[model samples]
Target: MKKILYILVLGGLMSCQKEKETVLKEDIQFLKIKNGLIESSYYENVESIKPIDGFIPNDSTAIRIAETILYKVYGENNIVKQRPYNIALKQDSIWCIQGNLPEGWEGGVFYIELNKNNGKVEKMFHDK
Candidate 1:
């Protein structure tokens, strides 16, 4: 009976350690950074390293362009928190990404506009 009790306790401890390790690994996989741009999968798939061509704009392409332009104005800390941007392509090949601003800011939602043909930022503004 004594030997059986000791074995059970050891098994439980090992299982607990494994559980902790799994949690840590999961946390690490939640976020990733590339090309000095930090994006996380914890909330949404917000970053795309792959480059696209032509006048078509997908979530990855729009995000990559938007983040690049936004990064110049705001640091990674300010941008990463605004994930899962609401994106749309409007008339004249305009690709726009609208993300929410942090609390206590003057604006509520930030609008980032880009020319789909050349990936050039046309305008960036926010709703007051």
Candidate 2:
């Protein structure tokens, strides 16, 4: 009984959560910095890192870009909490980015990338 209890306890601790969080990229990318993961982080299958735009200021002098290291430290789906980050900006375009780092991620360096339409990163990175 004691051994069984120990195994169960360890198993529970090592298990992941199941939650649902959505990042539409277009719908919610306005002056917002998103930092959450989707279903999984599988290569080529990883969630996209897109840009968000908010009501652009009327002044419209220059854009500011920021970046932050993002990580999915816990959760499988139903609920997720990610670290705060900055956005990277250039020219008249704006963007928000989220990417996973290596095993020892304390948060990596992030730069701005423009987001355009439902296109791929390459296509979106240059959209104003």
Candidate 3:
């Protein structure tokens, strides 16, 4: 009986660890886009941006970068329809921008941290 109880507890812990790992993996996939660059749709419409030679995007431009990918994934008028909030520049030229869910939405928020020098996203995640 003791051995059986121990086994059951161990199994439960392992399952919980696996679930945590899966959530992390999904978060990574959701944030990262192919080649870590803006898709063609943004270039087609936004003349200020250059895809090949990435620009040093500031607070406003960082929002554009986030929106470029968000618009692609969530469509033009979806979760990202509203502008990102709390755009701030951190040490080492890292720019952080957050997109919030619609009013009364259950989900918490999405964050994009990018480099100011080359406009490359260092990390992105959706928080619940």
Root-mean-square deviation per candidate? 14.5, 22.5, 21.9
lDDT of 1 at 47: 62
Per-residue lDDT over 6-89 for candidate 1, one digit per residue giving the tens place of the 0 to 100 score = 999999999999999999987766555556555534547456454455554566878887787777786666677676678888
Better structure of 2 and 3 per lDDT: 3
User: Ten consecutive residues with minimal summed lDDT in candidate 2?
Assistant: 61-70
lDDT of 3 by residue, 30-127 (tens): 55666877455545755564644247545778777777876676566654544547788888578887776668767656677888877777988766
Candidate 3 structure, TM-score to reference: 0.47
Error of 2 at 121 (Å): 1.2
How high a TM-score does candidate 2 get?
Answer: 0.21
Using TM-score as the measure, name the better of candidate 1 and candidate 2.
1
Please give the ranking of all candidate structures by TM-score, highest first, separated by commas.
1, 3, 2
lDDT of each: 0.74, 0.35, 0.72
Residue 59's lDDT in candidate 1: 62
Clashing pairs in 1: none
